[model samples]
Target: MGKIVLSTNVTLDGVVQDPDGQEGFELGGWFHQFVGSGDLEAWTAAETEEAQGAEALLLGRRSYEWFASRTPSMADRVSSTWADSMNSLPKYVVSSTLDHPRWRNTTVLNGDAAKEISELKRKVDGQILVYGSYQLVRTLIDHNLADELRLVVFPVVLGTGLRLFGETCRRKPLRLVDTRRVGDGLVSHAYEFVSVNPV
Candidate 1:
């Protein structure tokens, strides 16, 4: 069975909003500001390891559009394994509203997102990676579909914004399987979902 891995970058306070300041969120550029503070080589290596295991990319509509619009440009500018993996991987976008996806190796999945992901899990071998698709990740969490979650935590705290684990998120118990230090104050925590019994 293919694993559904949820990967993300967040502030210390758990904010996962527009880190690049592209979406009009006032606290958008926190991630970029702190880029030089950490061990960039370790962080980049972690990302490359992640891409090396993924079979395809799974994203929400907005994320799909964001990556679709930006990643190809990145591929044109950079010659790296991470860029190559991102630009070449098959990507499935979960959205009811997005009709056409023009990105190379892109497919739009319109239906119950969790169900579609479940079906995809059965068909693919390797990991189905999700990045910056917090809402969809929440759905997968609520439905108990996510296998692993990796969070690259930056040290700064954004006082307010869209958090990775929001108020609406279902409470889940996760096992910390691994941890690694990224750039300066950045750390990556890899967790595996586990069943929790009600007290």
Candidate 2:
């Protein structure tokens, strides 16, 4: 079975939105503005490396839109670098209104996320990676579908914005598998689901 790994760049307060001044949330970009210069490069390299090993990519509509708009010219470049290396890895976008994906090797899924991911895990040989889609990640967590989480926490606080982990979510216990300092001062923490204890 394949693992569903949720990787995100978060703040000290766990905010994950627009770390790179791309989200247009006005207060969105935080990490990039504050973190050390080398941190960003190191972080991206690590993420790209993880993504290269994935058999498929799962994204939320917002993330899909962001990438589609931002990397229009780099479609081929992205595919060749990341998608092609993974044998043209497929992408599943979770959205209700997205009729079709403009990007190649992409599919729009409008169904039970947990069931779909569970089925995908049974069939795929490599990992299924989820990046920068907090909504989808939350759903996966709520459904207990996420197997692991890779968080690169930057040393800054946005004070407000979309958080990586919302306050309404039920507490989920995780086992810290690894921790390392990447880039300048950014800390990367890898955690696996240990158990879903009742609150």
Give lDDT tens digits, candidate 1, residues 1-199: 8899999998889889988888899879877787772456667777888887899999998898888887777754543878888888999999888877888898888987778889999988989999988889888888888899999988797799988886544578889999977866788999999987768
Compared with the true structure, what per-residue lDDT tens digits does model 2 show for residues 1-199?
Answer: 8889998888899888777786588876676577776776676577668867788888899987776665546546444354334335687888889996887778887887778778877887778888888888888888888899999887887788888887536778899999998987989999998775565
Q: Flag regions of model 2 displaced more than 4 Å.
A: 75-87, 167-169, 197-199
TM-score of each: 0.92, 0.86
Which candidate wins on TM-score?
A: 1
What's the number of clashes in each of the models? Answer: 5, 0
Instruction: Please list the Cα RMSD from the true structure of every candidate, rounded to 1 decimal place.
Output: 1.9, 2.8
Worst 10 residues of 1 by lDDT: 70-79
lDDT at 26 for candidate 2?
A: 81
